[model samples]
Target: MKFTKILAAIVTTAALFSTSVASHADALTDRAKSGKPIRIGFAHEIPWAYPGDKNEPLGFANAIAVGVLKSMGYTNIEPVVTDWGGLIPGLQADRFDIITGGMYITGKRCKNVAFAEPMGKFGNAFIVKKGNPLGIHTYKDIKDKDATMVTVAGYVNVDEALKEGVPENKIMQVPSNTEMLAAVRAGRADAGAGTYFDARNLSESAPNEIEPTDPASLPEWTNNWVAIAFKKEDQDFLKAYNAAQAKYLGTPEMLEAVGKFQYTKAQLPGDAKADWICANR
Candidate 1:
């Protein structure tokens, strides 16, 4: 009687285990079919996250984000705009499920949240005049510019430009890169410092209004990294995102997608084909 009772107990446990696995699988399928939109919060920064002409949250990262998430089986996705500085607080409050914007994963940032594996990298670039006619090649070049330097307000790039030794009084902070670029073109400033991709793309798309160049003299790199942040302790979502990133990064198709979005030059680790894939993908 004891042996028979034990065998029946074991059978009951096996049935319960099967039922749990089946339920979990059903949940995954149900979530995929829900048609409920995954609302993503975004902060504006050109070439990555920013508003469209109509003020819709739009840009490369915004675009890439929709594509990637949809490919992962989400159909309803929304881009909600928010102030850059307030993004984290909103995430912490559960205002959005994810941040589909351009942000780096750093040690300081990790204190508040978790991060996905690196998506790509970025390098700071200098926007100089035609022919680099100033002969300025380093961070020290700003002191030698004989003119002001421009950057956007509240951006680390401004701090970086300032650290290069330009007097605080000589630095101009504006609301956007457009304004900063205008200052450079109008000769209000000798040059501007910002993302490498933005400088290069502006030169390619606009032609002659602003020229893209690198500071050849700075002893330190401005900053270069790639990764995205998430709300605290959200390991379930983090696992999925990291899995998606690693899987995507290994494919030729991923490179093609990056090209489609034009993130090639800014994505780091020196993969020309990776660039091509990023651009094309």
Candidate 2:
């Protein structure tokens, strides 16, 4: 009788443990459905995700994320701002429930965080001092001219520069675009590299100081896309988020939400799956 009692107790404990694990796995999705606040982490980058006049998160990625969340009945959202390099770390630490900054989906990142479908695609561009000093038009030119290039830390542009034969010593990784532009203006670097739109935005802001390289001059290898990121373990939440995204992405509503941030129909990611990008990139 004692043996049977012991066996029953073991089975009961096992069942309870299983239930607990299941509950934990579904907690994020459940919280969303219940109208609880879901935290979104974003980096301050122009036209991507940045603070607005009221310090509220605004930009293309932020708008898209908010739209999808609202469509899913997840109305309460809290925005968390951090440096671009800290976004993934913040998500992993439970500082936020998702990352919506115009984060690129790379293979290395795929190993760390789960990505939703891609939302936009773009190529690289360089911001050179007015009059094109150093003749820096492409990543290769930075190396050929033995010039230094600046990019935001943790940005794929850094990798693109290095791949084009620009030595590590010639690459300057700053904490943000503000520092990146400062470095170029201070002559600490010959050029600043970033997404095509990012470079164009900065150059337009300071036409007398810098100008963006011709978009057509950028190589095909420098092209990349952006997506939202989530913790790898939050598969349930990710599934729910993707379902909402499927219904909203590429629709007029999606474009309307992001168009103000300079995102157009051409920027919309069509038939681009995150899994394929992760595997190929």
Candidate 3:
């Protein structure tokens, strides 16, 4: 009788464990269909995915995610805010189902996470004081003048500057564009390098304090494309999201969603495959 009881207990425990494993496997697909809240991670990059006045996260990436997910019946989206460096690590730990911010897709990142099709494309721009005090229109100017410039800690802007012969001592790595702009304003940095959208948003808020230098005039700073990031195991979720993205991108609704940040149709990425981008990067 005691032996029978033990066997029954073991079977029950095994069944429970199996059920838990199945639920874990289902994750976004099952949860999304069942009306569970989808968690997305984002950094506080201006006009990308930052908290608005109401403390609700609103920005270009957030808008796109909301539109696509809502169209697919996944209305319950929970935003997980983190710093720039924490985005990938948080996603790997299952802290969020997706990184909704404009994470740039590169060969290195491709090995770690699967990326959706390219959504936004941008080149590096500089945030300088109103009158361009240092006459810093390009990275070369920063290098030539031996002026210090600020860039976000994890962004490729720092790399762009380094490649242009801007020494390490001349580059200050801050955490956000807000601080970078502040660094320039405080004379801690001669300029701040970031995405064109970032410069536009920052300058618009304080037009008298700063302005964005035209990146189009630079010869070496080619445009870089950005895409939504997903875990490698979420193949099914990626497919569903991509299908929705195809329908949502370049539509009137898409423009309306991101237009508040001054995103133009020209900023939309072309039909370049992620693999090609990864290799070319």
Candidate 4:
């Protein structure tokens, strides 16, 4: 009788634990449906995710995230800002529920977090001194000229540069786009490497000091897509998010949300899916 009672207690506890685990697995989905606030993590990168004049979250990625969440009835959103390097760690630490910083969906990052479908595509470009004094039009130019390039720390541009044969010592990692521009303007580096839109935005802000390489000159392999990130365990939330995204993406609403940030229909990812990008990239 004693043995049977012990076995029964153990089974009951095991079943309770399994039920709790299942409930937790779908907690984010349930929370969203209940109108609970979802935290969005973003890096302070222009045209991706940044603070607007009113200090509200604004950027192409943020707009997409907000639009999708709103469509899913998740109206309450809390923005958590961090440096680029901190985005993944912050999400893992539960500091935010989603990463909406226009992060690239790389094969390496795929192992860390689940990504929603890509929102858009972009290519690399260089921010060079006015007139591109050193003729630094491409990653190959940077390598051939032995030019020092600066990019944001933790950005995929850093890896792209290295992959293109730019020496590790020739590439400098900074904390933000502003710093990258400063490095180039101050002559600390010959060029600033970033997304085509980022380089264009920075160059336009300081037209006399820098100019962006024609994005078309970039090799096709340098092209990449950006997506929002969610914790790997939040499969339920990611599923609902992707479903909403399918309905929202490529719609006029999506275009209007990102149009102000210089994104156009040309930038849409089309048939690009997160799983394919992860597997292939």
Task: Report lDDT per candidate.
Answer: 0.64, 0.88, 0.85, 0.90
Which of candidates 1 and 2 is the stronger one according to lDDT?
A: 2
Which runs in model 2 stand beyond 4 Å of their true positions? 1-24
Q: TM-score of predicted model 2?
A: 0.90
lDDT of 4 by residue, 1-281 (tens): 99999999999999999998867856567667677789999988888899877668899899999999999877899898999999999999988899999999999899999999998888878899999889988888999999999999988888788888999999999999999999999999999999988899999899998999988887887788899999898898899889999999889888988889888888889797898899876
RMSD of each: 6.4, 3.8, 5.8, 4.2
Error of 2 at 33 (Å): 3.2
By summed lDDT, which 10 consecutive residues of candidate 1 come out lowest? 272-281
Give per-residue CA lDDT, model 1, range 142-229, as digits (tens).
Answer: 7876567777664556566566677888778776667777777778877777677667765665576667876334444555454556
lDDT digits (tens) for residues 133-249 of candidate 2: 788888888889999999999999877777788999999999988888889888999999888888899998898998899867977756777999998878888888888888998
Candidate 3's residue-wise lDDT over 141-220, tens digit each? Answer: 99999999898888877777777899999999988777888999899999888888888878888899999999886654
Predicted model with the maximum lDDT: 4
Provide the global lDDT of candidate 1 against the true structure: 0.64
Q: Candidate 1's error at 246, in angstroms?
A: 0.6
TM-score of each: 0.69, 0.90, 0.85, 0.90
113, model 3: CA deviation in Å?
2.2
